[model samples]
Target: MNNLTTEPDMHTALWSLVRNNNKLFSQKRNLEKFRTLLNIISENGTIEDLINIMSIFLYGNNAQKELIENTCLPCLRKLPCEDLPKLDERLRSSISYAGWNINETTDWKQKPSLFELCILACHPNGYTRERAVTALANHYEPVALAIALIRCNDWVSPIRISARDTAVNIIARINTDELMKVWIVFDRVSHGQRHGDISLSKTLFPLLRERIPSNELHLQLESGNSRTRRYAAEVMWHTHQSLNYSDLQALCACSDPYVCFRTMRDILPRLDQRVRTKLLDLVKTKKWAPARLERLRLLMTDQPECMHDELLDALCDRSASVRNFARFHLKEHSDVDMELHYQRKLESPNISTRIAALAGLTEIGSPIVADHAKRWLKEENPRIVAAGLSALPAEVIDNCEDHILKKVTNHSLQISKAAYIALCNSPPLSAKITPYFQRDDLSERQSIYFANLLLLQSRWEAVAHAISFCRHNSKEVNKCGVFWLQRWVYGERKFWMTPSKSDLQDIHRELELSHSNMTEALMKEIRFLLDSYQ
Candidate 1:
């Protein structure tokens, strides 16, 4: 037999074996055909062929499994070596087809044992855990799916996506308390999206809406656990179906303040005006504790002018949420009111309210308001002073420059930051501010900001004056000076002081001989700079 006749015969024979499988591993043709079959279909196979190949590998007989275990799997374990490049190339193409079909292999009729999944979930390879998490959607066992959902968050990007989408399957169908466990998992991570972004809402929200008639979702919404209830309130408005009006009324009157607030913010806006009015009437008559105060929001919505006094009274409400609501609502009105109705609010006993009021005045930008607010700078309350600094008009800013420079080193960080930001804007204040950078009481951060400003405005002599603090007794102060030196090297064109090897040497010489107290810290900083530069 010549090679030509033998090759075609071999191809025809192996394809026939693939079409009808028996555990016939005895032939060398089987091994060559297996690799050949994967390679031919690997790059350009039809969807049907890919599916068949996937099923072959996943549920194929012992010989096919052994073929992968011995051949492509070993090559894929490392990068493509030069000697056997064809093997590496074929292995990679085959593995891509294999990975693409992981979700299709899930057996919904029987949940895998916890021990098996635990190993996959705990696997160091991200792709393995990704497969395990995504496969949970077809899983029949609720508790097992819940456990896998928690582990999905630990995997890489692909796994996290599978975890998020599969979460909807578990969330929509799971029983009351079971879904709460998923919510607990969600809260541990920082990101959750609604609509077209990263959230269980894309599926779970619609499913919950569909399943509402079952009362299962309702039970979770009203769960004894506050966290579960909170999740319900948060996600309730995201569904395609509107929440039932009676359900909204009841949740608004819920004992949980968080639930009530969430209902008012999310659910109430979509309610009919007549329904809100009727609910407000019923709550006012019934004196529902959790929701009675929520009536102020409706009043603000329908008759905002009539609700001004009531909102003012709410500012004193003991609940922080209520106070925040009042502050925000009042600021909204202050935007339009020529009277600045919240003026009295600047003196409101609550510090947050006072800050909000001052901020309102700031945005309004009335010189008259600044005149009244400037007294806040002298009041000794640093928060009030900070607000005053932010609220002042440019015309009035110079009048307060001397006072602002003093507060740059004020014990209150908020006041000091406001003072630094305000002075940095006024070039005249730069002269007055430079000397304070060297004062022992000044914070290192304060000095860095001050020094940077001087350089930013071409005040080279000021930075030269304060260069000694690079070896200051305060470690924080020394660190700040070193950071400034670093900024100079990175080459900011606006600065007056440019970094040079000779210039740094001269400064180092002065520090070593003139300042014996901080030789070590200074040397450490210089060495770090030298290493980084090189």
Candidate 2:
């Protein structure tokens, strides 16, 4: 065995053992041999040999196995651009087997192979450039940070956007005032353009405080795109020692719901009752988009009574997102006024308002509310009726079983599809609904949806059936089946035994002929895992 191990041909030695014995190399012993081979390669193996060995291990038995940290990773990191393409291919192959743990590779940031990623990003070929950008972002190498920053200004907008987002994330981790200034400048330039994102801008502001001059800052904040100006007001509300009369007037009168929400949240704690009352008035009258109003509602949760009048008013906001917040906050108290507000929406002229009202009623968890929904199911508009049924609780679910099953079997595809989703969600839906799988009336997308729902509940027998339904020739079904299967496989790997060789053979056979998007996705994952070992 020692003589065989010393042979120049690493693959030949491993193959001999695999072919000759049932268990000559268990995972533990195989791991040790892998480490030794890695060391030998790091010292003397050619790149061609390395790529070959790595590719073979990928998408095979070694996919789940861990790589031994030999000096090769650090050495490979220092390899030149000419050597990067080979290494990139090998890395993709070995992803399954490679330990992504950053600490393992010594001086990993200083590696030249990492720089090769930058070259790939700026590669002449468009597809190669896109792939390189993705590969670089995913690599998580700290040394690539500076290069990524430069690429943010890339001539191509798409590449620049990717690079900018990557740089923002990397900068976020540094958590220093200096980095914040850089982000603030970049954000200003990109504001109202394609790259402006509110969440990222708000985050950079607080960090910029001590680094940027206050006088210069206030001017920048008061101007710019609507989103930027709103965030600026939020910054002033947080950092201003004493709100100047002008600042107070602006903060009080700002029309953006986010600006108002942030002001209320930040200043309410520090202001006198007189000021808080003034701010509450601003919240009530300001026409806000639904999402921002939701934030204000959540903020009011600690003292709902203080702003009850305003929150109740928001329940009628034209935006469903805002109404969602209203229902959520209002339900926490469950007062008569809030329930009355919901009841009115149920009869409102707008279809979305009716949908929001049903969801709101469900959130309240009242039997009276559930009963109301059941009555609405008899209405002519099937869509509204379907939504009403969807909002019903489990106990209510049992009572409506007959009606729901009938709808599932309805000739109208929309009605059937909606019924299928609702029934699958309801606990009373077991075995009774299982027969629906055999119904040829069901669309492939509908079947795929059910398959995923079953997988989520860990109903393996049901999941197995669902997997078979993946035969629906739709790309959507194939994509969904493959995703759920991969998730199922990952979960099984954690708690279950390693898959048998026969199982791998079965998957490989299917891989060759299957047209499912999932098939390709699964193959990629399997290959990534196998490559990790290399």
Candidate 3:
């Protein structure tokens, strides 16, 4: 009976009882061992263990009924409600184990235990579940009722009918608190796979309205676990329950983002003037971006006069969605020149604000944005320079090519990477990048970028670039050269005109000079291609 045992020992003990189930059921001493093992399993076993036990119990013969009812049912009831969905999901996905199927008896005179009925309700066999539904009609524990509610969506019609009736009867008799405890299970199952015509909203909402007071519902919204809080909020909203300013404010401040968003989308617009002002103050302090974005949108729609200041502040907001929302509204609703506004923001000391402004001005395509970008590229701060490089347009890239090329060798990899991406499309700058590979100070990434730039050039120049890269010190860069050479010699011959014999000989000679760096496989492929040309 000691619950503290290793998992392998406990697993062996449980399966031993399952293997000798008949002897365990028929003998008195073995029944004691069965009860003890069930105790250890109920305490220390996992979801899979409990599920295996349930499968055994469901397929038990009449001789095993006493042990199953007296010992197994009570232990199974010890399973927490949270584990039921996991049990249900596992049962749904797997077929019943053939080893557990000792008898197929479905007929019984007396009603089974509530926990027993609950397990049977989830039986993978449809008929077994249907029998459990009928047996469940007389038992109404909260967990039992929740399982019955779940089965109302059973793909089998008779089971769904029996379960819906059982759920309706139990919902009537159960108090609000008891019903609330099972709400998470009921809500989960309602949305899960269902083929029946039963609508949970139509069945449960009326009962919720009759039994659940507004204060209790709000308490659920404020303090329940995530699933319960979502269900409670949804119940209150759909039932058209009126929430006081305090309740609305609490909802807006709820740590759950979806609840906060629903409050803004569904509840905020209908508030009275006094409550609206209070809610607005609370919403302004909320840091979640989706809630803030919805609040800004509502302000634009419901209170246009206050939006000018709100939208301007939002332009500096951390979220791109909020910033873009502000930009669109500012352009549509006000005479304030967005270009001038963003221009002023570009000079702000805050790095994030300056980045946002740079992005905005770039989107506006203002001619002065290039001037600001040129100046920003010269700044000592890498962030501003990186932002400037990202916002620099195609027209201005040629103008700033020298500044960008300098950053390609910058000590900060962030600025260097941004500079490389900006220069990637400028074919004119490719020739200037070749000398950078020879510099010993270049980082690993910078060396790779210089090597990869060869792939963007014409065929003969690319050959020269590959030869130059193979002579670099980094093996990774050398691999990039070998990879391109392999592809050019073996893969690209059909795609382009074959190089002249002298050009091929030149490639062969250069590769031979750098052959110490080439792998044996690469040398063989290059030799074959060059011999063909000869």
Number of the top candidate by TM-score?
3
Q: What is the per-residue lDDT of model 3 for residues 176-200, given as tens digits with 9 covering 90 to 100?
A: 7777767777667656746746666
Instruction: Tell me the tens digit of each residue's lDDT in model 2 across 1-534.
Output: 366554457656544443433254566876577566656655654666555444333322322122422333454444332354445545543543443222332233454244345434544444544555655655554334444554554556677656666655655464344343343334443342344333333453444454444554455455646655654674576566646545655665565556655665566656665555555555555556642463465447546566676567567665667766666666666554666778887788988677767776666555566777777778778777777667767777677777787676665666667766776765334355557545666666556555554444434443443355356566576567666667765865566434445544444554444435335666576555433423
Candidate 3 residue pairs in clash (backbone atoms < 3 Å): none
Shift in Å, residue 507, candidate 2: 13
TM-score of each: 0.48, 0.41, 0.69
C-alpha lDDT of candidate 2 relative to the true structure: 0.54
lDDT of 3 at 374: 77
**What's the candidate order when arranged by decreasing TM-score?**
3, 1, 2
Q: What would you estimate as the lDDT of candidate 1?
A: 0.56
Off by over 4 Å in 2: 1-235, 238-260, 268-282, 285-365, 380-383, 399-421, 427-447, 453-458, 493-534
Task: Indicate which candidate wins on lDDT.
Answer: 3
Which stretches of candidate 3 lie above 4 Å from their native place? 1-29, 58-65, 68-75, 78-86, 89-108, 124-128, 134-142, 161-184, 205-232, 254-259, 270-281, 284-293, 311-335, 349-351, 378-383, 399-534
